[model samples]
Target chain A: MKQYDVVVIGAGPAGLAAACEAYQNGAGKILVVERDKEPGGILNQCIHNGFGLHYFKEELTGPEYAGRFIEMLNNTNAELMLDTMVLAVTEDRKISMINPRDGYFTVQAGAVVLAMGCRERTRGAIGIPGTRPAGVFTAGAAQRYVNIEGYMVGKKVVILGSGDIGLIMARRMTLEGAKVAACVELMPYSNGLNRNIVQCLNDYGIPLYLSHTITEIRGKRRVEGVVVSRVDGGGKPVPGTERFFDCDTVLLSVGLIPENELSRSAGIALDPRTKGPVVYENMETSIPGIFASGNVVHVHDLVDFVTAESQRAGAAAADFCRRKEQPGGEPAVAIESGENVGCTVPQHIRPDRIDQYAEVFFRVGRVFSNSEIEVASGGRVLSVFKREHMAPGEMERIVIPKKFLENASGGAVTVSAKEAKEN
Target chain B: MTHLICIICPKGCHLNVDEQNGYAVTGNGCPRGAEYGKKELTNPTRVLTSTVKIKGGLHRRCPVKTDRAIPKGLMFDAMKLLNGVELSAPVRRGDVVLADLLGTGANLVVTKSM
Candidate 1:
C-alpha cells in the first residue's frame, strides 16, 4: 500500500486537469490512475476539431486539447499509474486499483478526485427492440475504431441518434467512402451543435430525419437493414409511419450516463437529476475529501469547460488535503430549469458568493430565436441576458455576477428562458 | 440574383436571392436558413483539419488540425497546403505545425504524434 496526498482516478481530460491543479496547489504526493495504456482518455479517440474555443481562445481537436494538459502534467510533481483500473473507493477516500503492470494496490488518500468520466448509453439501456446483431455499435466505439484503429465498421450504415457523436460519425463514415443512409433523430430538434449539423451532415449531403426513430433493427449475424418511423409530439412512435432502409450497421448515440458505480459502492449520495455524484460549489461530493468533475459530474459538450471545471475541483481537493482555508460559506440554492431550458449543474448555488460570480452551464430543450434568459430567485429576476438563438445541441452558460447573489435573500433560484418580446 | 445555399442540416435549402429587392429567401425551413443564406451570400467559412510534416519522430506522418475556425473559401486551399507538408518525430501534440496558414489567422495544430 502506498499513500499519496492527492489521488485522481481515470486520467482523462478532467482527471489530468485535476491532478495538475492538485499538485500545483501544494499537494505533496499526487497520483493519477488511468485504466487505458495512455492517459488522454476519450479525447484520444476524438479526432475532430471544435474543442478549446472558450478555454484556449482557439479551436482544437480532441486529442490536441487534451494533450495541452498532459504536457502540463508532465512538468509537475504528479505520478501516474497507466493500465490501472480503480475498482472501488470508500467514503473515507480509500482506493483499490488493479494494474496488470503494477499488480493490485490499496491506498488511503488525503483527497480523492473522481474523474472516471461518463459512459455511452447502449441499445439495451434504451430498449430499442432489435435482434442482438453483430454490426450494432455505439458512436464512440465506431469513432475509436475508425479514428484510432484505422478500420471501417461497415460500408453502408444507418445511425440511430442525432447526438454529436452520431452526427460526426455520419460524416466520418461518408468521408471514409461508406454510404450513410440516414441519421435518425428521436427528438424534433438535433441534440448536437448547429455547427456539427452543418459540417457533419449538410456539408456531406447526408440526411437527418427529425421526430423519427429506428423502430426495429433488422439483421442476423450482421445488420442488414433497419425500420424507422415518425414519432408523435409526445415522443412515441405513430403507427403506419414506418419506413425501412437496407443498411449494414446501426450506431447508437442516445446519451451518456456518468460512470459512478464506484461512487455508489462507496456510499456517496448521487444526484438523480445529473445521474452523477451531487457536488457542491467547489466540486466536492457529499463525502468530504472526495471530489468529482468532468463527465462524471455531468456530461459536458465542450472539453474546454471540462478542463476549467476540473481545475477548480483539483484546487479544492488540494486545499482540502492541506487543511488550508477555502472560499466557503456560500449556501447553495437549487438551480431549476424552466420553459425552454433543460437541466443545470452545481444545482445548488451559494447565495453569499453571488458577489464573486459563478459560471452556470446548461442546455436548451429546443431551438428558439431572440430569447431572454433570466436567472431569478423568489420570482424576482436577478439578471437577464438576451441570446440571439439557443439550441439543444449546444451547451449554454451564463456568468452571473457575484452581486446578484449578494442581493438575494435566499429563495429558489432558477434559470428560465422566455421569448424576447418584439423590440 | 445571388443564389445562396443553406447547409445548416441535411436539409440543404437552395436559397434564391434578389440583391436589388433586399434578398428575399425562398427555401428555408428554420431561421438558421436565413442566417446561413446571409452568410453564404457574404463570407462562407469552414473549419479545416489535416496533417503536417514533422521532424525526428516514429511514424511517417503526424496528424495536424486547425487551432481555430477558418473561412470556408480557404478550406480547399488550406488542405492542399497541409497535405504536402511533413513533420519530424518527437513532435508533441498541440505543437504548431503551421502558423497562420495562407493568412486566415488560423494556426494548424498537431493532433497526434507520430
Candidate 2:
C-alpha cells in the first residue's frame, strides 16, 4: 500500500482548497482524490455569477471562482487524482480507492481530510406525493443539463423550492428562453440569499409563492402541470388554496444533505443536525488525524466560506500529521444549538487550545429581525452578537474570544438567539 | 425612492436610494453599498455567465462569461450574440469570445478550457 502524509477526499472546492493548504503548510506527499472527470466540482455546472464576492473581493461566476482555485492548485505540488472514486475510508487513515486507470488500491495516510461536499435532497426525501414523471429533475441535475450539456430541460418550468440553485435556475431557464411559471417555497421566506431572490427572481419578474408547496405532480410521462398549495405553520397543506400551473418541468431544490457515508464507515462521530462528522476547534474529528470540512461537515451558504474553512482544516490536518496527536483525550466542551439557532458546526471545542479565536458557524431555525445572538458557556453568557436580520438561508458566525474559553468554567457552550430586551 | 439589496457580498445590506437626491444611500453595511445603490438606480448592469457551443470537445458546450459587468438591458442581446458563436476545443480560460461586447467595453471570455 502506498502512503501519503495527507489524503483529501473529493477534489471539489473543499478538497482542492484543503489539499493546497496542506501542501503549503509543509505536509509532504499530499494527495487529493476526486470522483469526477475534472476539478471545480459543481461550480462548473453553475454558470451564474455572484460567487467569490467575499473571498476574492469581486463578483465572479462559479466557474470563475473555482478557476481561481484551480489556477492556485497549479502553483502547488499537491497531487490530484481525477476520476478516482474513494470506495471506503478507514479510521486509521487508510483509503480504498478505484479508477479505470488504476484498477483498485489502498493507500495509507498520516492524516485524512473529508471534503466530499453534499448532495441535493431528492423528491423522495420530501415525499412529494405524485406520479413518477420524466420532467422531474433536481435543481443541480437540471443545472448540469442546461449549463454544461447545453440541453434545455423544458420550455415551461415550475420549481418546488426557493433554494439558491432553484432560484438561480429559474433565472437561467428564463434567460435560455424557457418560461418559468413560479418558484414555490414551503417556508414563508426564501431559503436562498437575499441577493439571489432580488436578482434571480425579482429582476426577471418571476413570481415567488412563499408558504406554498407542490402537493401533487400532474403528469403521465413528461410533466404537464402541478398543484401548488399554501402550507400552514405545521407544514401541512392548506387544501383550499391550491393553485395550478401548467408546466412541463418540476425542479426540486428542497435542501442539501452532507455526504457522510465514508465518515460513518470510518467510525467518526456524527452530528445529528448537520448530518456530518463532528469536530473540534481544529476541525479534527473524533478520531485524531482525521479531519472534515466544508459541506462534508455542514452545508455552507457560500462556496467562499467553504474555501476559507477547508483551508483551516487543511492547515490543522497538516499540523496533525507533524504532531501525530492522539484521538480524543483532551478536555473539551460540546457547543450546541439553543432557542432560534438551528445547529452549530464544530460541535466541540477544546478550551485554551489557543487559535486566537474559535469560529462557530450555524443557521437560525427561522427568520428573526431585531435580534441578538448570545454565546453562553454553562449558564452564563460569554458574548453577544447583534444583527439587523437573521434567516435560515444565511449561515451566521460568532467568534468566541480565546480569553472566554480560557476563563470558561468547563461546561457545554450553547449558542442561542433572542429578541433584543429593552434596557 | 428605491430599495435595493447590495449584491456586493453575502451581507446583502438593504439600501434605500433617494433617486431624486443624487441617489443618496442609506442602510448600507459598507462603502460599496453606496456605489451599488447609485449604479443600480442609474444604469443597472450584470455579469453574463453562460455556456457557448463547443466543437471537438468531450462536452458539447464551453462555459463563458463577460470579463466585466455590462448594462443589464443588454443581457438579452449579449446572449443572442453568443448564440451565433461556436468555438472549437482547446479554448483556454480567459480567452476572448467577443471583444468589447456590444460596445460595453467588456469582453465575453471563456471561463474554462474546452
**Candidate achieving the largest DockQ:** 2
CAPRI level of candidate 1 = incorrect
Native A-B contact fraction in model 1 = 0.18
* Candidate 2 CAPRI classification by DockQ: medium
lDDT of 1 by residue, B30-82 (tens): 78677667666666666666444456654344566777667766766776686
Q: Candidate 2 on A1-423: residue-level lDDT in tens?
A: 998999999888998899889988999888989998889889888888878877888877787778888888888888889999899988778899999998999999999999999999999998988799889999999999998888999999999999999999999999899999999999889999888888899889999999999999988999999999999999999979998899999999999999998999889999888999988888888888899999989999889899988998999888888885554466787787899888788788887564688889999888889899998876898989998899989999889887777766765778999887778
Report the Cα lDDT for residue A193, model 1: 68
CA lDDT scores, all candidates in order: 0.81, 0.89
Question: For the second chain of model 2, what is the TM-score against the true structure's chain B?
Answer: 0.93
Candidate 1 residue lDDT tens string, A257-308: 9999999999888888779988766788888899999999889887878988
Count of clashing residue pairs in every prediction: 20, 0
In candidate 2, the residue pairs with backbone N, CA or C atoms under 3 Å apart (3 or more residues apart, or in different chains) clash, namely none
| Regions of model 1 farther than 4 Å from truth | A324-330, A338-340, A351-355, A421-423, B1-110
